[model samples]
Target: MTSPLDSRQILRRQLRQARKNLSNHAQLIAAQTLVARVDHYLSGQQTDKLKKVALYLANDGEISPHLLCEYFWQQSIATYLPVIQGKQLGFARYTADSMWQENSYGIKEPVTADYAPSRDLDLVFLPLVGFDSQGGRLGMGGGFYDRTFANKRPDASPQLIGLAHECQQVKSLPVESWDVPLQAIITPQQSILVS
Candidate 1:
């Protein structure tokens, strides 16, 4: 007899392992295609002027955001990496030379005395285990992103954008009350922007 929470955990484990199984060649190609999709979306849009964009370091089979980091640097958009702070998440400025350390989860984070609050970011790139076209996202079940960005108004400064591999897409996700919907989802195959 499995509880809903248990089922969710099972699904997460399956998805996480599936991604981890990706061949290095496959992951590399997916990473390249991902940046192309993101670039297409921002082609005509003035993303270069977006003051602050929050990004994450890949862990537990999450797709890498390293290519996008290079693109953002070329366009002069300040990049930030999420660090686990207390019970929630915080963003520290990420540069090529930023000092880094691993958090309790063994995820790398930029070590810093200063961090930018979520409210201060103009955009956020989320790493996900699974997603659907309707902007639903399945995170690592820690609720870090949910709690950190829970205060976003209908119209907010930062728009959350999910990054995933095409294989991560699912028919749908069971949405929880606290799940933060994304503005768009970018994958190696396509980009689905929420209306």
Candidate 2:
């Protein structure tokens, strides 16, 4: 029998392969599915009470946040995006037509002058490559998100939510000490409330 660590490695490799094999159309459908599910969640909740939110632009094989952005924008809620500066991240308000330039990794981000870090954000939506039922998240091997959350004040922690496809779910995942678990995970299939 394979050990848990070995199984995790195998599952990670298989997940990567499956994502790579997805056609553009299929990826769009998957993203739409997840977006609809998330929209349903938001529709049932009150957006006015949510003063601030952190969102990530979709990349790699993650579900697209384009529709999600429209929903939040329509509600007139404040939306923020992560800007990587070295090993740290600063959250910046992002509009549908926010001016963005590619970072070193080719990820688009808002210009520094437009950034407004919020320590009192009500929620944060994170992108995940893989996640478990308990909210263990695996990012793109970059610790930027983890480091950002680490810097949050103990009394001002934002509600962290991981966004991903249903296929990204695994039985378990390996986590490091510095890794901060999410409050919930939203997938194409269902929304998992970890706390």
Candidate 3:
């Protein structure tokens, strides 16, 4: 029998490969579709409270939220990017003029002192390798998001949303206790809300 850890690792590898195999055209279309879905969701929410948002720069073929960020900026919403802060994670405000520095993982991050505490943001969007219908998210084996958002309480200000390509969804995820479930997972196909 495969342990949960082993199962998760295998699933991650498969999903990562699936995403990386997307052609440039497919990726571009998927990203545009996802942005449209997110835009529709926000407009239908009936509130202007989701102004401050945190999201990551796409890496390893993960679905890109760059379009979403651009839309938010146009709408006057503040955009933030995650920074690797020691063993955990922190967020730095991102703008068109923000200077970017590459982290050890070769991912670009903002190196700035102006960072908001995680609890202050209205919404956080995370990239997922694999996700299930019930909100289980399999990340890149780095516990950054989970560790950073560990203190997220019920009805918190930052509603966690997982961003992924349609091919990344799985039947169900093998989740552990420490795994932080997402409030919603958005793909090019649809946006699923999980309780």
Candidate 4:
């Protein structure tokens, strides 16, 4: 009998491959489309109040945020990338001239000593393996984001958002107690604002 934990692991592998199967052209289109979707969401909110935003460097078929990073750069919003610190994540300012170092995961992180605590950022765009409409997020099984934002309230300073491709959404996800809910999930096609 497969336990929920085993089921979650199986689901993660399937979803990861599902995204990996996207053609390069399809991935590019999705990344471009995501910029517009996110832009539309920001239009309804108070933009001036949002100063810092943390984003991830795409890895293992995770939807790319590089284009969206450029869009934010144009708007003069400081972009940040997550740096692994012990068991959690720390945010470091990412810029055109930022130096890079690969973490254990082989993902590039800004090579800087300065880092802003997760709470100081205005927004955080998390990468996920799968997500459901009710704000549940299944991450890469590292537990980094969950531990980093464990204390974050539903309505906290740094609004947590998950970025993914349309194919990544599941009808329902097995939720774990340590899982942190997203305030919103943005895909190339649409945005799901969790209440």
Indicate which candidate wins on lDDT. 4
Clashes of each: 0, 0, 0, 0
Answer with 2 or 3, whichever has the higher TM-score. 3
Q: Per-residue lDDT tens digits of candidate 3, residues 139-194?
A: 99989988988888758768898999989999988778888868888998888998
Off by over 4 Å in 2: 1-13, 43-45, 151-155
Order of models, best lDDT first: 4, 3, 1, 2
Superposition error at 142 for model 1 (Å): 0.4
**Per-residue lDDT over 1-195 for candidate 1, one digit per residue giving the tens place of the 0 to 100 score:** 998778778888888888999988888888888889988987767775688888888787788888888988888888999988887889999999899898898888998776888899988999999988888888889999899888887478788899988778888888899987788899988889984
TM-score, prediction 4:
0.98
In terms of TM-score, which candidate is stronger, 3 or 4? 4
What residue pairs clash in candidate 1, if any at all?
none
In model 2, pairs of residues that clash are none
Cα lDDT over the full model 2: 0.78
- TM-scores of all candidate predictions against the true structure: 0.95, 0.85, 0.96, 0.98
- For residues 48-136, could you state the per-residue lDDT of candidate 4 as single tens digits? 88889999999999999999999989989999999999999999999999999888988889987768888899989989899888777
- CA displacement after TM-score superposition, residue 192 of candidate 1 (Å): 1.1
Regions of candidate 1 where Cα sits further than 4 Å from its true position: none
Model 1 global lDDT (CA atoms, 0 to 1): 0.86
Any runs in candidate 4 off by more than 4 Å, and if so which?
A: none
What would the TM-score be for candidate 2 when compared with the true structure? 0.85
